[model samples]
Target: MEAIDGLIHGFGVAFQLQNFAACLAGVFIGNVVGVLPGLGVMTAISMLLPLTFAMPPVAAILMLAGIYYGAQYGGAICSILLNLPCHPPHAVTCLDGYPLTLKGKGGTALGVTMLASFLGASFGIVLMVFFAPYLVRIALNFGPAEISSLMLLGLLAGSTLARGSKLKGMSMTCLGLLLGTMGTDINTGLQRFTFGFPELDDGLEIVALALGLFGVAEFLKSVNAVAPVSTSATRIRIADLWPSRSELRTAIVPALRGTLVGSLCSMIPGTGPTIASFMAYGLEKRVSRRPQEFGHGAIQGVAAPEAATHAAVQGDFIPTMSLGIPGDAVMALLLGALVIQGITPGPQLITEHPDIFWGLIASFWIGNILLMVMNMPMIGLWVKLLSIPYRYLYPSALFFVCIGVYSVRSDMFSVGTTLAIGVFGHVLLRHGFHPAPILLGFVLGQRFEENLRRALLLARGDLSIFVTRPISLAFLLTAVLLLGAQLYFALRRRDEIQLPPSASPILDE
Candidate 1:
């Protein structure tokens, strides 16, 4: 009864004239962004966050949240119809989905993909419905000691997720943390590393840092990077969106497995949909009877990754809401947006802002339904999006980054910082470094320091305070275990080697 009443209240809030319209607009924009390449949820949400100045905070957050998860339903449209992946999460879909198209089963692929995605998302929503609030209640009681320990775990997990040498990833993490602290001291009324520049007083604009690190760095990589000219995407048709009986059966187990894998993996900070989907697909392939069929248009292949994408997207929101730790870049941007709106997304969010919490959660399912209806009709549009020439697209992507970053700070310094970080990020990439973990570190580093200092202050400068607190001890133990596992795995693994993208798609081929 209580849940129903709360849900009714949510419906009352969400179904209002302007709020409903915002929901539709958000779903529409989400599909557009998800269908297009290079424009990630973070960039899209950050770019649009400024436009929310005149809108209600709830409505603005509702729309941005839609863009974040609606992509779970829409991104595969391009990956299946066009060989080009819409994003990293959908990259695995390109493996079997495109080949399924070649086999004249494009309709089956699209249908099953949509169904699997819906199921996975629904599973995550169920988890959110029952579990999220309890988690929130527990987290709401956390002290600075506990918060700091959580951040430590987050950084360690992020470092573990990076693809390069752990040391190099840690180096980048240190660099990001140092950069994160470049402006003002949060504790004292003093400036730490501003170099007497007023612009540095506000710290590095997150939009600039992320855009430079992920977006601009991506553009720089493409300057001379090989572009495969192919004509494989023009074969899309509406008939490709329906699933057959056998195909549906084939998708069931894989979808279920993928959902379980993705939802579980999502709880671990920094494990985004891309890695979750890939692991789910790998697990399915390893356990399948026809392992040989993998990367050769296997139906299970399409189901697992698609399902994982949805589950992971929903699951990633857990840490974001519970602990204020963004799971990935998109979540980071969402966190930033919430901060801008004067709505901190910590444990108190659910209790203090029931309307925002319940409304957003309810809207997720609405957005999922809206996603299917919105994306199915736009398959042709998304196919055309995939058909766009890289030459023209990248420049526009860069321009959007520039405009978005500049809009955040109203200064050219951000643009310059973006370019500099981008170039430096590119150079680091070439020298075998990854920025994703650095982003995680950068996002949590300040809070980690604050919490650590607070815990120390409370303990009267005793280092043993970490072990004195039960939650802190648990996190420390987990970190030690994680580091131990990483060492064991790294030692047992084969020599490091780079694999080409062409070969990458079919590593399990």
Candidate 2:
């Protein structure tokens, strides 16, 4: 009943004319960015965060959250039409999605992806709405010791979650924490690693780093090589718009299965769509009547991964909005936006900012529906965008990277720092180090440090407080168990001189 009232109030807030318009605009623009490779929901949301300075919090978050899941639906358009995944998780969609395209059943694949995405997203949001109350209550009372232990668990769990060696992941996490430490120590107010450069005082902008790492690097790689995109597609007509009943039935079970699995995995910090899709795909195959059809344009294949990814996208918001723990790059962006808007995301946010919370939740259903519309008949426009050649696209991308970086605090030092991070990120990329764990660490680093300091201060530097707190102790023990299991597998892998199947799928690029 409390959940119902919150949802009702959310609808009340979201129904305002201006808020409705913004919701539509956000979802529409989300599709545009989603179709464009590298301009993820995080980039789009972060770039647009400043624009919401004047808008009501309800409208701003509604639009921002709209962009979140709308991208999930819109990304599939490119993955299905072009072989390139719009985002990495959409790469899972490309597995069977592109194959379906080759068979000229692309229309069916797109429809299934859209429907499954909507349904799975809805499922996740419903769970979040009801579960948030209980979750938030428990999360709110967590002290500094509990928080620090949670961060430690998240860090170690992330090491096992992300690609590469546990040691390498630990190294990357430490490096990110180190990099994150550069600007100024909040506690001491002293600059550490400025290197005497005035620009180093502000540290590196994530936008520039991300733009270069994902946006610019992708452009550079594309410029020198040919990427696969279908040129012979007969523009899909409306007559073939909807999926057949048989096809819908084929997709239902996979979508449901994906939703169930994706929701569970999403609660784990550091895990995201990459694992969710793989788990969903494996689940489908395990229960499949025709398991051999996977990777061969199976509708279930397309539906399962798409559904799981959508659920993951929505479920990822759980930690971000409730516990103030960012689950991914996009959540970090949302956190920044929340702070900039003077709306802190924590346990009290639900009670203090009910209008913002509910409004954002309600807009999700609207944004998802808008995405379905965007990806269908309007897909023609999105696909037409792919026709714009690399020369033009690269310069435009470079412009955004430089401009977005410079726009933040008018710092040229940020641009320079970005280029350095980009180059370093590219090096890490080549060396098989996924930059995600670093991002996770950088986001959590400051808070982790803050919590550790606060806990020590509160306990008068007594380390026994962690062991005395039952909640903190439980979290610590869980982290230890997870690390022990992960280390065992890692050692076995080293002895066999082979990578884990989950970490490296031979079929992946």
Candidate 3:
């Protein structure tokens, strides 16, 4: 009943003319960024952060949240029409989206993706409305021991579940954790890794790091790559936008499954849309009656991942809002924005700032509806954007990256830091390193260390508190189980590879 009252009040706030307009503007910009290759939600939000400094807190958050999910909708356009992903999560869409395009079903694919994204987002928002409060209530019982252990689980899950070698992911996570420790220590008032620089005491700017890793690195990579060219030109009519009855039937179940998977994954800190999308695709493949069709224009292939990614995007708000813990780097930025605006996110957020909490929730539904309505009509426009030359796009994006980083603190140091990190990020990418885990680690590192130290201090330097507390023990045990599972799968794969050729009946035959 209390939640219901708060939601109603939130709707009242979100319906205000100014807040509504902000929501519209955010989704509009987010959509544009999402349609452009190499521009991710993180980059878009990071670049836009400085602009939000002067806005009212609720309106600023509503707009930022609008951009976050709006990008999820826009990313599908490039993935379907150009065999390019505007964001990392959309990369999975290419498996079937481009194949559908090749088959002259691009319009249908786009329409289905839009619908799936809407359904997924709606489902996630519903879960958020109901589950977030409960999670917050539970979190209120947590001590420093539990918080520390929980953060460890998040970090471990992030590194272990990321695509590619777990070892490499862990290595990147360590790098991020180290980077995160480069500021002044809260307890001692002493700078740790500042190297005698005053600016360093405040810590490395997240905007600089995000722009460097995602924007600059992407710009460098895209500049050298061949621009994609459409092999055929076809004007899709409105009549062609709807999928066939059979295709719709085939996609329905997968979309639902994806929504469930993504919503659950979003609740787990450190897991983001990319992992959710891939997991959905993998599950769809496994359970599909005709798995062979997956890579060759299966309707479910496009539907499942699209739904999962969008759902995950919305679902991330659960942890971010309720526990004040960011599920990913983008959420970290959002949290930072809230903190900058003198708003603290946690269990009390709902009680103390009901308008902000409820209003933001209401805006999510509105923004998603706007996305659905706007995306369908704008499909042709997004497709047309592909014909624009890469050279033109890259320079404009680079300009924003530089300007955005510089604007963060009105300092040239951040600009230099972005450039340096961009070079370093590019090098890492060239060597098969993933940057996502690093960002996740950096975001959670400070909190993890603070809580760990606090817990130890409270326990008089006894580490057994972590094991004695049921909640802390549960999180730690979960982390161990996850790691053990990864090792088991890795060893099994290695064993299969090492088996003698003669031991295989197919080879012997």
Tell me the tens digit of each residue's lDDT in model 1 across 1-509.
55566667777888877777788888788877787666666557656666765588789878888888876666787787667686788889998998988888877898898889889998987777777777887887788888887887877777776555887767777877787787788888688788888888878777677777778776677656635335454565667678877778889999999999999988987778988999999899889999989888999999999898899898888888767987776777777777777888888887788888778777878888887776677676766665567788778878777877777768898789889988998888787887766666666777778888998999999988888889878988998898898888786553333545564433435
In candidate 2, how many clashes are counted?
0
Residue 264 in model 3: shift from native, Å? 2.1
Clashes (candidate 3): 0
lDDT of each: 0.79, 0.78, 0.85
What tens digits encode model 3's per-residue C-alpha lDDT throughout 1-509? 87788788888999999899999999998998888766677778877877788789989999999888888888888888778886889999999998998899988998789778888999988888888888888998999999999888878877887778889999998988998899889989989899988999988777788788877886777687756656257466566778888888988999999999999899877678998999999999989888889889989999999999988999999988988778877787788788878888887888888888889988988998888788767677776766678878788888888887777788898898899999998898888887877787887788889999999999999999999999999999999999999999999888878887766433321
**What stretches of model 1 exceed 4 Å from their correct place?**
1-4, 223-233, 494-509
lDDT (Cα, 0-100) at 350 in candidate 1 = 78
Q: How do the residues 1-509 of candidate 2 rate in per-residue lDDT, one tens digit apiece?
A: 99999999998888899889889988888788788765666557645665666688778877887787777777888888777787777887887888888898888888888888888899888978988888999998899999999888877777677755777887887876786787778878888788897676766555555555555555554465644354556466655558999999999989999988888878987677778988898889889888888888999988988889889888888888888887766676677667767777878889999888888888777778777766667867888776667567667766777777777667677777666776777677677776666766776777889999999999999999999999999999999898898879877766655766776544642
Candidate 1 has an lDDT of 0.79
For model 3, the superposed segments whose C-alpha errors exceed 4 Å read 226-228, 231-234, 244-246, 500-509
TM-score for each model: 0.91, 0.91, 0.93
Q: Which model scores highest in lDDT? A: 3
TM-score of 2: 0.91
lDDT of 3 at 498: 85
The deviation in Å at residue 64 for candidate 1 is: 2.1
